[model samples]
Target chain A: MKLRTAFFLNTNKMKFITLIVIITFNTILHSQSQTGLVQYGHKQSMGMGAPIGIDYNANLIFDNENSLYTFAKDSLEGGHIRESVYIEKDKDNFFVNSKITNKLGFQYYVDKENKKLLSRDIGFNYVKEEIPTINWEISDEKKDIGSFECLKASTEFRGRTYTAWFTTSIPLPYGPWKLQGLPGLILEAYDTNKEIYFYFKSIKYPMDSKIKIQKPNSESENKEWITFSEYKKTLINKHKKAIENGRMLIEGFDSADTAEDKYTMGNSYIEIFDNE
Target chain B: MKKILFILLCSFVSFGFTNERIEPISENESAEITLPVKVETYNFPYENGTITLTIFDNGICEQGTVTGTLSTHCDDDGIADYVWSGTICREHIDALIMQFNASC
Candidate 1:
C-alpha cells in the first residue's frame, strides 16, 4: 500500500513538471514574435502643385537580428481607399515585388550585426547600400509624442534637409521607411518643405505576432542587383527619358496625353538637382 | 442540446465577419481617369448594374449612379455610403470607385 501511494505521488509530480515545461515553451515562443505598427502619412504631388496626403499603417516586424517593414492595408473607413499602391506578393513563391510603373512601395531589409542595408526598388533591383551614418545636430527642443518626451534633431540626407524627433527611451535605433541611424527610434521626420513626413500614430510592444522576413530570392523575375547610387542613377535616367519622349505619366490620366498642358507633373524630388 | 447547437451556430455566424469584396480592374481594362469627372464604367457584384462614379480631384463624389437592375442593399448595410455621395478622401476614393467599377 505504501509503494502504491508513492507511485501515485510520483505520477502527479511528473505531470506538474510536464505542465511547467509546456508553459515555459509557450512563453518563449510568444516573446520571439513581436510586431510594432506605425501609422505613417505620406504627402506628395500627384500632379504639379497638387499635393495629396494619405495615411498608411505599416508594420515593423522585429526579430533578434533583423526586422521587416511593410505597409498594412488601410483600415480606416472600411478601407474605403483601396491599397492601390503596394507591393505584390508573388503567389507561387511569396516574394514581394514593387510595381515598377508606379514605383509605389519599396522594401528595406536591415542586417543589424553587419550594419548592412538591402533595398529593393520598383524595377526589381536589389540595391545593397551601407546604412547611412547621419550627423544629427541634437537640439534642446523637446516635445511629447504620445507619452514619450522626444528630442529634436536635424540632418541633411540625399539633398534633402530633414528634421527628426527621436526618443531615447525606446533604445531601438530604428524609424519608418529607410530613415534610421538615430540614437533611438525616430518618432517623426520631415523635409524642410514638409513634402515628406512620417508621423508616429501608435505602437504595440510585446505583441504576439510573427513576421517571416521573406527572402528576395523567391522572385521569378530576374533580380537586377545594383548599389543604391546606381539605382538612383537609373531612376533619374528613367524620369529624364520619360520627359524627353514629350510625354509624362500622370496619376489619373492613363494613355491620355496631357503633356501639352503640363498636366503631367515633373519629378518633385525634394533634393534640387545639383551639377556636383 | 438545443442550447449547445444554438451556441455553435452563433460561433459559426461570428466567423463569417470578413471584409467586403472590392474587385480590382481587369487586366485588359485600365484604371486611369480624366481630370474633373471621367471614369471607365464597370460592374460591381453587389450592385446589379454598371456603376460609374464621377469625382473631383479633391475626392468629392458628384455621382455614383448605376444602371440596369441596381440594388443599394449591400452598401446600405455597411459604412460604404461614402461611395455614393459623401466627400471621401480622393486617394482611396479613386481606387474604391475604380474597384466598384470593375466586375469580379
Candidate 2:
C-alpha cells in the first residue's frame, strides 16, 4: 500500500477498510478488560501525639470502563495505627478519612469513557466533576510485594505529597479511595508525613459476579450532584462556623490554643485543597 | 409543665450555673470522672470528645462529656472539645476559676 500512489488505489474502498480496522481495534481493547475486586487497609494518623490513627477497609471493584471505590463498614473505635498503637481517642471523634470520603452513602465512581468522577461529601453534598489530572513521576526503583513486582511512583495531589507502589501484573488503573489514572494497579500509597496510608490486603480478581458499573444515583441517595468546588465551599463554611462556635463553647480552644491553628480546613480534610 | 419549668429556671438563675472546660491536676490525668467529693474541684482533659466541668454556687462539682464535632466548642452543649491531652489542675474550685480566667 505504501509503494502505490493514492491515485492508483481505489479511494472509496481504502476508506472502508480503514474504518473496519479502527472498529476492530476498539472492540479488542474493550474485550480485554478484566473485572476484579481489591481490598485495601486504610490508615490515617491523628497526629496529636505519637503515631495514632484510624484504620478501615476500602474495596474497589473495576473492569474496563468504570471503577467504584466503596466501603463495607465504618469504625469509630481507636484503630491500630501501626502494630501496637491505636487511636485511644473516643470512638465518636470524626476521623479525617471518613470525613472526606465516607460520609453518608459514600460511593466513589469513575466513568473512564467520558472522563468524569462522582462522589459524596459530608452534609449529603454530592460531587460530580471532570477527572482531575495526577502527574505521577514513576521511578526506576522496584520491589517485590507478595508475588508481584511493584514499581514506585510519586505525585502531589490536593495538598499532600503521596508515594504509591503499583504493579503492572494487574494492568488496571483502579486503586483504593480516589487515587487512580495509573498504568497499573496501585497496591499501596502513603503521604510524605505518614499521616495517611493505604496498602493491599486481599483480592478476588476476575470476580464471579457480573461487574456492573453503576453511578451513585437518586434511587440510593436522594440528593442532587454538585461540582467539587461547591461541595468544598460547604465544608469550609461548616469549619468556619465551628471555629466561631468554639470561641463561645469551650474556653481554651481559641487562637492561643493548639486546636485552633492546626485545626484548619487544610489539615482536617483528605483532599487538603479546598478548590478541588 | 410550666410550673416545673419556672422553678427550674428560677433555681438556675439563683445558683448561677458556671460551666468551664479544664484538665485535671498533674497527679490526676487518667483518674475516674467520679471521684470522692472531698477532692474539692477536679478537671478532666477529656480523652475523646468535649467535656464540661461545672461548679454551682454551693461548690458542687460535676463533669459531663458529649461526643460530637460540633460539641468541640463545649458551648451550648456545655461540653469541652479539645483533642489535645493536657490537664493542668488548680485544686481549689475558686482558685481554678481565677487561674483559668487569668490565662485566657
Candidate 3:
C-alpha cells in the first residue's frame, strides 16, 4: 500500500510538470517579435495605355510562425486626404480619381504553420486564403542588389508569371506584398508584362523598434471573414446592385459608359481576376 | 463683343487649367527655442500639382531643405526618407503660418 501510494503521487507530479513545460514552451515560442523595413519602387496602372510608376515603403514583422506585412505609408501618414473633386454647375468636366497602388489597405498576415493567409480588405473585413503555392524554379543566375548577392527565381502566381531575386544573406524568407515562399528575402520582383514591379531600395534587419501585429477577431458576434472567391462574388453582386439602383451613375453618362470608365481609367487589383 | 467674350473665356479657362506654384517667403522670423517648428510652403510639379504648407521641424532640416518638393503628392510616392502630407488641417497650417510670420 505504501509503494502504491508513492507511485500514484509520482504520476500526478509528472503530469503537472508536463503541463507546465508545454505552457512555458508555447509562451517562449509565441511572445518574441521581429520587425524589419523594406523600401520598394512600384510601377502600376489601371490597365490603361501606360502604367503609373510609384514608390512605397513596407514593414515586415513576424514571430516564430506568423508574419504581418503592411505598407509603412498607410501606417505612418496618419490621416491625409488623397483626392477630392468639386463639380462646376452645368460644366462638362472630366476628372479621374487618383490611381491607388495599394487601395485595399491590406494588412496581409501569413500563418506558415497553418499554411494560410489572413488579409484585411478595403471594407475593413478580413479574408482568409490558403497560401498560393507558386512552385518556384530557382536558377543559378545571380546578381547583386545593394550589398547582398541575390539569386534568381521564377514562378507563376495567380494569372501572372513573376521573376524574383532573393538574397540568402538575410534569410528572412519574406517579401513585399503577397510574393513569398522563397528560401530567402526577395529584393526585386516583377511580372512578365511589367505592369507591376517591386524593386528593393533598402533593407533593415533586427530593426530598432517593436511592432505589435494584432490579428482581427474572426469569431466575434460582429466580426466575420469570407473566402476570396465568395468575396469576389459578393463584390460583383454589390456592383450589380449599385448599377441597378443607379448609385454609381455619372451626372451626364449612362451606366455602360461609367462601367467602361471604371475598367479603363480606374485602378485594378494586383492579382488580375478572370471575372473582370 | 462676342470675339472679346470668347477671348476672355479662353483666358479664364487657361488660367484655371494652368499649373501654378506658390511658395511662402519669410526672412526675419526667429524663435527662442533650441529647435523651432515653422511653416514652409511648396508647390510640386508632380502628378496632381499639389500646393502644401508644411510644418517643418528645423531640427531635422539643419542641412537645409530635407523634403520640400518631394512630399507633394503624399509621402508614399515621394523620394523623402520620411513620410509627410500636404493634407494637414487647413486651420492648423494657417495658425503655424501666422505664428511664423509674427515671430522675431
Q: What DockQ do the predictions score, one after another? A: 0.02, 0.08, 0.02
Report the lDDT tens digits of candidate 1 across residue range A190-214.
7765556677777765466765665
- Give TM-scores for every candidate, taking all chains together and pairing residue i with residue i: 0.51, 0.60, 0.53
What is the model-wide C-alpha lDDT for candidate 1? Answer: 0.47
Query: Which regions of candidate 3 deviate over 4 angstroms?
Result: A1-35, A41-43, A48-55, A84-95, A99-104, A208-210, A217-222, A237-267, B1-104
How does residue B37 of candidate 1 score in lDDT?
Answer: 30
Ranking by DockQ: 2, 3, 1
Instruction: Give the interface RMSD values of the models in order.
Output: 18.5, 11.5, 18.2
Report the lDDT tens digits of candidate 3 across residue range A1-276: 999999999999999999999999887544442455666665553232233333345556664466666652454334333431211111221222222233324477888888888877544557788987778999999999989899999998866778999988767677767788898888898886565677777776556665566654556427678998876665455434323222111111111111222331112345655564
- List where candidate 2 sits over 4 angstroms from the true fold: A1-33, A46-51, A72-104, A252-259, A274-276, B1-104
Residue B2 in candidate 1 has what lDDT? 39
Provide the lowest-lDDT 10-residue window in model 3 chain A. Answer: A249-258
Clashing pairs in 1: A81-B92
Over the stretch B1-104, how does candidate 2's per-residue lDDT look in tens digits?
53344334433432332322333456746653433322122244434532333332223323322122212222211112222222222122223222222211
Please tell me which predicted candidate would have the highest DockQ against the true structure: 2
Task: Give model 3's TM-score versus the native structure.
Answer: 0.53
Better of 1 and 2 by lDDT: 2
